[model samples]
Target: MYSALKAGFLALPYLSLGALAALDGHCPPLGPVLPAPTQPSKHEAVPAAAAALRGIIDQVTATYNGSAVAIGVKSIHESKLLFEYAHTPANKEKRGAQKVDSDTVFRLGSLTKVFPVLALLKLKDRGVRLDDPITKYVPELRGLKKQAREDSPVWVVDWDEVTLGALASHMAGIPSDLITDIAPFGNLSAYGYPPANTSRMLGCSGFFGTAPCNKTAVAFFEHYGQRPPAQVPFSSQTVYSNIAFPILSFAVEAITKRPFAEFVTNEIWKPSKMTRSFTTKPDDALGFIPPKDIWWDANLGFEGPEGGYFSTINDLHRFFDAILLNKLLPPAQTRKWLKPVTATSSTGLLIGQPWEIFRAENVTSDGRMIEIYTKTGDLIAYHSILVLIPDYDLVATMLLAGPEVSGSAMTLMLSRIIQTLLPAVEQAGKAEARAAYGGTYVDKATNSSITLSLSDDGPGFSISRYVIRGVDVPSTDPGSTLPPATPPRLDPPMRYRLYPATANSGRQTSWRAVGTRGTAAQVDKADAQIVWPMASCLTWAMMDRVTYNMGARDHFVFDVERGKVKGVEAVGYGVFMKKEC
Candidate 1:
């Protein structure tokens, strides 16, 4: 939840390239795009490189609880990294520190789903349309619709209607996860994080309890294709699902007439020269789950399509380089690699495919807005996040002990490294941007207030900050713990970073609620409860996706006359906040 930009303007990651130089040029070495326009080599970055590296290590180590945490930040235009920080100490010395470098291999969880998507993109380029149904290719599911008998216990809303596009976008009505109530895991179904592999996974509650062949990926799909789904799939959703990935992979495998692994090795991996990356195999690697005592090797087994690949930072950088360099796929097809599968989420976010598309609010130091075509993955032992930032020509990736890391923590760690490597800007261009929308505004109808100021940090031009109060805050529970004197406030305020939407939106910034503050004189989640009787009956997922307050409109509209600020709408919870400044 922490933004590295908040670490003041100076904190940056130091380049730990001691081991990077050892791994020389790749065969058919990539073109010069990655290393061009390079600044002075990392060593000459003024104020000494030691502080930056040490600052990065200290920041990460402060939160990283496990034995090994490796990170890499490199420019898409340059082969060398701006910074690479790896800390692994066995018994606190962190074992395998040397062995776990840019070249060390580790399981890349759901990221494995990317290759199948890549292959599908290639096929799409070759006349395989995306809108067609999977039945068009497999024929195994040609006649199956949401058919169910009177005695059927589960709703058959998802069968027969799933398309290749749906499968790829996770909109196929497949359950959010791949884990089943039956099999290798006993009671985890009580919670949602399902087992990564479906080999021993069996259906119990939703649809496939008595599914005859519940062992392999092929069998599970066959079982579902022949039957009805447990839940409804008509609505396009960005929910997580390992079920759709393997099915998509099967479709790719069928079309290519080659094993997924073999095809990728020849067409994707070998061409990119990612020699260190592998499938279901370890190359002198160690996965630390609970290094408090020992480690465990998390296996993908039949989840190969979902998460069975092992790769390193070096090969990962090279792989992205290949894509950017137009070695594996052309720029046009590669661009499709990051396109949104569906419109489930807001702009800048696309789910269910290999790379998670998030257009970040914060701009790079060089003033370019960032579109993060990134993916986060985890086995029982290893967790990682890899991203390709096309606009800045940057790629940052990292992997570490999973059990000891939270997804937010991992993201923050990477953000810390990324914040430093990005081109630095001395002062924000907030004054001009703010003149039209800055200062205090009050909503007389609701007795609410909003205070907007030029952000003191980050890229100044495109960012603003606001603290809202009164009706702007969600309603509190009828029976609350606090006294009447205490009221809800926006607390630390939220960052209103400007983003480009339509041509009009391009003139201003489009932002949403993203930051969080600590539990210090703040409105609590439990306190903001809905008092309606039917509110309790709403499903968790339903409430999560449905938007209540869009924080004004999708874009901020400012009313200005001559040089004076007038009013603003479609922001915060205010219907209209007239400028009072």
Candidate 2:
């Protein structure tokens, strides 16, 4: 009986092993298990500035009815954490209350363009010049066509000669989408049509069955047999990034023989030691995928070259450090990335290769001058700002994610925050200006020469200007400021000169002025002219709020003694300036 029982036990073991084998074939292994990622240390104390930022984030979240929001700010000079806050609601039932932490990732949206620029710079380091024609890399963009109208002839253009520089600077002249004339199929999903938006099209494996988006990009190269037309003046309307991203991605893949995402991870994230940064889907639970609730279904899965990546604020700071330090690309290349390539007058800002350039003016606590380099980012449900005071080695980044907000509102909020935290920033700048210049001066206008006196007014300073020639001018008439019947044309012998009222103030000098020959009747009588005394006359006027940083010498270089002004830069309607003494 004992021998029989042992035999049964042995058979039972075999039977169980057989069943396990069957289950293995049906279920398969769970694949390689990646260990949980280490979280960043949280020992650092939150800065007081973070409190103010948290309040803003709180307000914005409540106002927008957003689910969750995260913010991160760091001082680049000290590499110190200024502020980091993530908030979500306690009740899962409430859409806006889900809590978030530093590790929580969020879709960078259009911020994905930064990676492509880095990738291109990487290739440039490998003997590829940005000025090289598109044909040099992708031969498919030969003969590109544009539909003129419903029944109109199609306009074809050669895109081969378009250079990488043009693409990077957004001067490539490509439209936002291929189909521009006809209204896009609005109800794509309802009409049984695939989501053909740029994001969806780029993410799909086979787009519209006509060609893979990547192939379509390549085909664009093949069809446009020659170079694009010669360069024209840089205009915002002339630059488009939708066509640039895929083309650049294709180039990186072609040259490196690696996926664009992988190339970025190895070249950018790894070297920067950005532990929390990722290009592909991350394994950690904290890993954030774009909120699919906003648009596409989450089950479908979506990824694209334009805006399909996730990252943390901390990781982004690390990335910025790499770019600033010239660790990923050489110094020259890094300089190229930060250098302003195109001028965006619409914003009264300059567009650099990767940075948007602007002038910030600030009064210091001690009444000094403060100028700084400022860059900002706007994405779906997120807003970011990066200001670098190179002289002070100071850099600040502000990131907010919740509900959509207008770009202007975000910029205004950032300006307010800077104002509250760094009141001394502008004061120091003003003091610097005082030391630079404090003296009386003279200036000339088209019809008359004006003498101005600058004296230390007890409370602050005062300036006065009087017309030395021409007819007496009324002080209060609205139409008195208008120029004569025939406007003075800018030509030889009839020149306009700007004289500085104060070295520190952006206002021009009183000694120089617009000059024109006028009939005696139109000229103002010397005694009849009224003199207006004001502390300082406005020279360069920008309607938008100005941000200033005291630490950086070049922050507001344009407003500085020798900064360049391509033309009279202005912001918003009715905001302007005339050369006044």
Pick by lDDT: which candidate is best? Answer: 1
Most accurate candidate by TM-score = 1
**Deviating ranges (above 4 Å) for candidate 1:** 1-54, 62-65, 91-98, 142-154, 157-160, 180-236, 283-296, 343-348, 363-369, 425-581
TM-score of 1: 0.57
C-alpha positional error of residue 506 in candidate 1 after TM-score superposition, expressed in Å:
27
Q: Can you write out model 2's per-residue Cα lDDT over 402-476, one digit (the tens) per residue?
A: 434545766776665565444332233234333333222222332332222222211122223322234322221
Candidate 1 C-alpha lDDT tens digits along 1-581: 12332232113111100010101100111111111223323324412443575586676577545556777777665567766766654433244334456776666877777777677777865577667777677665543333234324253443346676677767777554444334543556667855546643343322222322332444454345334453455465555667577667777778888877788888889888888778755643333334543223334344567776878878888888888778876766665665656554576576635557775545443332345678888654567788876544567788776345656777777666555554321111233345555577766676655565544433222223233444333222111122246643433332223322212332333332211121212222222353522121111111112122654222345555654557756453446668886
lDDT for 478 in candidate 2 is 15
For every model shown, what is its TM-score relative to the native structure? 0.57, 0.54
Off by over 4 Å in 2: 1-58, 62-65, 90-98, 143-154, 178-237, 287-292, 295-303, 362-392, 404-409, 422-581
- Residue 580 error for model 1, in Å? 46
